[model samples]
Target: MHEKLTIDIETTGLSNQDEILQLSVLDTMTDEVLFNSFLKPSHIKAWDEATKTHHITPEMVVNAPTINQIRDAVQKLLDKASLIVGYNHLNFDNRFLTKAGFRLPERQYDVMLKYSEYIKEPNKYPEGFNKTPYKWFKLVDCATNLGYDWESRPHDSASDARATSWCYRKLAEIN
Candidate 1:
């Protein structure tokens, strides 16, 4: 079987232009943590809201290795995966990786998208016919709702990565 990996990243902001502060990748099939690191930012300032969400401060990353310093290793891990998965990765993590100069694997999966599709509710229309509606879900909220025991705090890269894996497994079982 082809290798499967799950990845998660914590950043300084929400936009693609934001700097990545932490990243985690896990080999899902093997249950091995392939890469986990906190990157020191060189170009962007850490936003207060982002820090509150991820609990990563500028001081915490001050002595950490920059993205450039670990790009090679991260790329290698990504290259080895036949499928790279993440929570909201297609819309968020992938863009940041590309902006930071990392080549992502071709086969990418977004657990958030899958979960949204699985639990989608029909939109209520007061004046017209109803249609399928897509709703955004938080990783922690999804995992807990699916009955998975998610112990790590939300927004931490490693914790999010693990939660993504749990979500993937649960999704697979249902399908």
Candidate 2:
């Protein structure tokens, strides 16, 4: 019941200045990730491995919306969010946002790092689900635990955002 907005960003490069391929977010109540978009790259040479992992071709993004365009649409989503959660934002995504020249409004919580301790503590979950056994529980783990199946593949911003929402809701329910 945490009003958390879980996000996932697929970018052309590792830095904030890099072009963003896609972005998605989910409000914590529903299983669906409500917001997602594919953005056109400002730079012609966005990386390949990053593209491969995300399964987004340059052509697909070439005609896609501009970063500023998508950002305008996403502003509403970001405004509604009480918490901003992602897989690794402090070092990566947030840095990218800084480079993007927009201040991502302060997030109430960073649930990704927080859940490490949630699962690590034996009492955080039911008996036998110990730290070693479930040492690492990503968003999919949370989805599976809560009876929401992860339908899409990973790396892409939309799927990753959906999975992240699932993971967050599960852990939030527990604690």
Q: Largest lDDT belongs to which candidate?
A: 1
Q: After superposition, how far is residue 16 of candidate 2 from its true place, in Å?
A: 4.7
How many residue pairs clash in model 1? 0
- Tens-place lDDT per residue, model 2, 17-127, is 576778777775574667777778776465787876777888777777877776755666676667777765654677766565555768645555556566564344445
Any runs in candidate 2 off by more than 4 Å, and if so which?
Answer: 1-3, 121-148
List RMSD in Å for every model shown. Answer: 3.6, 6.2
**Could you tell me the TM-score of candidate 1?**
0.90
For residue 139, model 2's alpha carbon misses the true position, in angstroms, by 5.0
What lDDT score is found at residue 121 in candidate 2?
Answer: 41
Alpha carbon lDDT of each predicted model: 0.85, 0.67
TM-score of each: 0.90, 0.75
